[model samples]
Target: MNQTIHKSQEKNMILERTVSADSPRQDELVPSRYALKVGEIDVMVISDGVLPLPTKMLGHNADSATRAAWFSDMFLPADAFDWALNAVVVRSGGKTILIDAGLGSDPDLHLPRAGQLIKRLESAGIDLASVTDVVLTHMHMDHVGGLLVDGVKDRLRPDLQIHVAAAEVKFWEAPDFTRTDMPQGFPDALRAAATRFTREYRNNLRQFDNEHEVAPGVVVCRTGGHTPGHSVVRLSSGGEALTFAGDAVFTVGFDHPDWHNGFEHDPEEAARVRVRLLRQLAETGEMLVATHMPFPSIGRVGIDGDTFRWVPAFWDY
Candidate 1:
């Protein structure tokens, strides 16, 4: 009986290996996307993979000892960190809206793990042609690079409308990076990506001033902190609401809301925006999602003494 069981186990292992080898991409070990509902609106959060960045990028203004202590407390590596890249898709009023695209290919940057948005969307059965609109949080490469990926334009509908803030377009016209503290080679890459995206999709842009309602109960509002035109998408229906905060909030913002992130063009104003948004979400008890938060990124904010707390929603599986 023991010999028979061992042989069966070996046979099963061999079969599994064969299947994985035949369809490597389809056999992901972990889930890459999550789906949920906000009242009547259907929402899905897809993971575009992760970006490994230096630890200092978390808070350039913070002292090394303080940053080290925070990292120790969180049990994270002291030298580097992996930032989650998340994009959202919403369906409302018969309109399909893509909140933000993920990082596309950039070999020069040496970030190979990212740029999975296109494949993941396809795996989720979301055809590019089916996307009726795209609402950008900002013109950052990670947010707009997916659209600029080769052949993505050909797949998308010719009449598809891309919603962005007027300030974002104007800022990128002659972008000012005096305040940003990005790593070397980032600013140039960002500038090139933004310029190419704007030039290629000039006619499809539907620039708005402050706020615009793309569909029923779906509103995109400019917050202007991370970038001049940075915005967040708010979905409301059946008395429930959820906000898709672009770069307004990061994972570390909960404990250190005043810390200056390296990517913020105006760090001071960005801090103010983070604090205000967290306070509002805490007071109203509404669900919040952000681009850099962990996958699914669905949760509520609670006031924890002087700082805020992230209450991750329990999986409804």
Candidate 2:
């Protein structure tokens, strides 16, 4: 296994650093804890750890210098231009549902360790046994690997209903998901993830043909841009509403909403949806939680002239 690189210094020179682990799990693996309330619904933003990813991976059209100028604070920790992985947890009508299960113990992949969802959920007094549902925004390595433990040990949400974008799943699991233009391990990892969506998981699994109320007060709507069948999960109750825009907007990624991520299946379509979704979120003024934004990634987008600005909310917990 590769060593986790950190910072270090010696007598009069700089020193390279790394974190070695006897076991896969590590403390503070996941940071960025927060929560919110939209009307009567309770929302929690759980950390899936942070990775200093390459800006090139974002697939933006801008040059490295321009991109760096745009996201000045994106280099908060290690002078890294990054997009964070933040998972959303929703509790309503006595039900607990996780929006996305982040990456597990996969180091070969650029993704980081984010299998702490179950532990963090348990810390919040949420019993894994009673987690009624798990709605995935998409089945990327970092999003769905948390469904099961490493080596496929146990079902994280045994009795919960698993929601997926049917077309997206088909594409990833298809024999040619990665042959043409997709990332290297996208298809292979997804195929392994099929086991997590077991017989019971599939029995409870569903796909949104159009807009449908998959759960009480929780509706799954088709919004394909990031992927072929990507969908947005929206919730409304007691006159207040919140939309979990999976990867539609990655922080200021929407600033250039027309900008697309490199990993996206359709850059043009993804760019189109990013602009359209940002416009909708800005115009509607709906509070949103996304799978990847900065830490504590739940906020509303505000319209500032043509571009929309991210308006972060204060999370009590």
Question: lDDT values of the candidates?
Answer: 0.92, 0.67
Worst 10 residues of 2 by lDDT: 15-24
Task: Tell how far residue 191 is off in model 1, in angstroms.
Answer: 0.6
Indicate which candidate wins on lDDT: 1
Give residue 49's lDDT in candidate 2 (0 to 100).
69
* Alpha carbon deviation, residue 97, candidate 1 (Å): 0.7
**lDDT tens digits by residue: candidate 2, 1-317:** 12323222242233122333222235554454676776677778887766556565554566767677666655433234555677877777778787887776663655544455656665666666666778888766677766655533344444567778777666665533331243456556656665454432556667666576756788877777677778888988877778888877776565666555766667777778887877887888788777777777767888877678889877553
Q: Give the per-residue lDDT digits (tens) of candidate 1, residues 222-249.
A: 9999999999999999999999999999
Backbone collisions counted per model: 0, 1
State the lDDT at 159 in candidate 1: 98
